[model samples]
Target: MPKTKKLPLNSLEWHQHPKLTTLLSGDCHQLSTLPDLQFISFAQLQSILDSCPIPVVKRAKVDAYYLLAPMPILKQLLGHPDSHKLTASLNIYSEPEPTLSTLALIKPALFYQKYKRLPEILHSRLDKAKSMNLVTPNKNQISQLAQISPSAFRKITHSQGGSHG
Candidate 1:
């Protein structure tokens, strides 16, 4: 599992939405936890997550944890339509929502046609870290070593002509 912290099981995006009105009008929550959640007992879990307009809603007993799958639907909702941006968002999150192949279709529209946007996102990340003085390069030795570390990803993708930027 990726490293992640537990929040209140509330939405990370609580202010705006998938529209609570529509969600509430329906009797059930359109989503549940990931399939892995099936391993946990959702017998006591509500079929849906409740919604309210109040800024502060009391923390209800959470029987199951729901994650917004970082899929095409969410990408479109976030106004980032490029697959590279979508993929990047998925990769960089502290807890990237799980992706499902069947239902996770990206819409026809895209924010960008090419992933030229990838470098920009990466640059911004580095810039933020630099601004915070979080980067200290080892100029002489360790920094001189190959940029890509040996591991499952490197070994698999290296022969295919992929290089770490």
Candidate 2:
């Protein structure tokens, strides 16, 4: 057998590194190659949720949980309703810590069924939120106004050209 030289981590072909390729391919299912987007399995997400709490704002009427997600992910989640029961909004309850970005209101069953792994940046943000005690079980609830229906919110987002700061 021929030996292959190990490339430095800083190399342009870092993604081709044996260890990184294995790590990404092993646990996460790739969604895109250009940006290298991969989604971790639902079971893996569950394990992470068990340890590092992701603050969920529950909507009792719709039986959904509003979770903070990046804009790109939120857009993807909204586009595929059949895959996941989801509606998203740039508007979210005012919070002092862990500044809000985009919120995806998703049903638990559907969310688990169509689990798409959050990006590393979001995971790190969640970890930071957890470490700072910004997220807690009690604080997981949001106001009624924040629980707008999927269709209504979708219309609003669409009308606004789907861009929010």
**Backbone collision count in every prediction?**
0, 0
> What shift in Å separates residue 37 of candidate 1 from its native position after superposition?
23
Off by over 4 Å in 1: 1-62, 65-68, 71-116, 124-165
What C-alpha lDDT do the candidate models reach, one value each? 0.28, 0.29
RMSD (Cα, Å) for all candidates, in order, is 17.5, 22.2
Clashing pairs in 2: none
TM-score of each: 0.19, 0.20
Judged by lDDT, which candidate is best?
2
lDDT string, candidate 1, 1-165, tens digits? 333333322223332113323333444434432221222122212211111111222122332222322222332223322222221111112322232211133421243333333443344444555689875332222112212222211122234333324
Task: Kindly list the per-residue Cα lDDT of model 2 for residues 8-58, writing each as its tens digit.
Answer: 112211012232233335444434412211243334323433443333333
Off by over 4 Å in 2: 1-45, 60-62, 71-165
